[model samples]
Target: MLTDYHVHCEFSDDSVYPMEDVVRDAIGLGLEEICFTDHVDYGIKVDWDSGEEIRWRNGEPFANVDYPRYFAKIADLQEKYGDRIRIRRGLELGVQSHTIDAYNRLTEKYPLDFAILSIHQVHDQEFWNGEFQEGRTQGEYNEEYYREMLRVVQSFKHYSVLGHMDLIVRYDKAGVYPFEKVKDLITEILKVVIADGKGIELNTSSVRYGLSDTQPSRDILRLYRELGGRIITLGSDSHRPDHLGAHIASSMELLKELGYEAFCTFENGRPVFHPL
Candidate 1:
């Protein structure tokens, strides 16, 4: 079955595309299954410009998904499109070391088919705006990012997979941070993830960012395989209709070339694999 496990819709603050439009577009592309992993980034306080704590809508600075509305809409869509396509309710959680309790509570409170643990910011500083990389060399920021990931992975256990393991490289202003520079730390993070029965997603957004590589890169994929880690998932990380399911077939082909025989989908927090 062709499935895209990472997707964003209207529920995500950064995305303006309606959830229904995303589902319709996925159906048009012949996707059998798609997961709505909308963003839920709590603990983000800064404005990225003033470097001051922000208090926006509902007294929260960052855009956190409205769980009640999000889940209710997913239930309705799932019932409406059950015969046409499989829709899974999921969340892209921006995990921080200090907010583990909040995430734990949220996960326990909801019934999520899948959850992606992503590090969107470090210490409330976003990488996209260069706040996380300022005053630091590429190597330093790279190592810091990996270390933060390792710390969170070691502590948090609610997520199904780590989203875009090398996401920091995408926003690095200095240059592409070499894998060798942070491989050791990444290995540790991967080890913890595998040991805890978690997986990693092959985020296809690299093409969107003109990276010429997947989020974690091909070398990291090889290492994950070499370490006996096999729970892999493919996602376009698309925020809009046009990008939905983008590059998924190519990503599966690449995984097959790398000796990955199968990729995964989640339901009720359990993984189910399909041959590539």
Candidate 2:
């Protein structure tokens, strides 16, 4: 079955594509399922009731998803289109070390089918805008990012997968850092992920971003396999319509070339495997 696990629509701060339209587009593309992984970055964005004004990026407001409205809309759509396509409720938790308590409360409150743990920002500094990487040497910034990631995985327990395990490369104006430099830390991070029964995402957005390879890179995938890590998930990381399910088939084929036999989907926070 073709499923896009990392999808964001109007519920997200940076996307204006409406949720229902996203479902319709997925169906038209012959996808069997599409999980709505809307964004909620606690440290960078505020909740709807926080009484703070939202910041915007390209006309879209930067704020956490409206929990009550988001879920209610999903429920209505599920009942309306259950026969046509499987719509799973999910969220991308842009987690940081100090924001664990906020995520803990949100996880306990939502009946999420999946949750992607991503380090979109650390210490409220964004990688995209170079705030997190400012004034630091390439090596220092990379290590610090991975260190925060390791800490997050060790302390956080509510996510289904690690979103874009090496996402730092996406915004590294200094160019891609050598993997060997951070190999030790990545190894530890993957070990903890495997031990906790969590998976790592292969984000297809890397392709649109004109990257040299996949978001996690082929080397990372190979390392995970060598570590006896069995679970992997494919996501387009799509915020716009044209990006949905982009390069998914090719990504699955790439997984097979890397010796992966299956990719996964989630239900009630547990993985369900599908052959590659």
Query: Evaluated with lDDT, which candidate comes out highest?
Result: 2
Listed in order, each prediction's TM-score against the native is 0.94, 0.98
Give residue 170's lDDT in candidate 1 (0 to 100).
Answer: 88
Q: Write the per-residue lDDT of candidate 1 for residues 1-276, one digit (tens) a residue.
A: 788999998777678789999888889999999999988776773323444554565443455777788899999999998999999989999998988898998899897899999999888788998998899888888888888898899899999999998898788767787778787888898899899999999999899899967788998999999998999999999988768999999999999999999999999999998999
lDDT of 2 by residue, 184-227 (tens): 99999999999999999989999999999888999999999999
Give the Cα error of residue 135 in candidate 1, in Å: 1.1
Clashing pairs in 1: none
Give the CA lDDT, 0 to 100, for residue 136 in model 1.
85
Residue-level error in angstroms, candidate 1, position 242: 1.4
Number of backbone collisions per candidate, in order? 0, 0
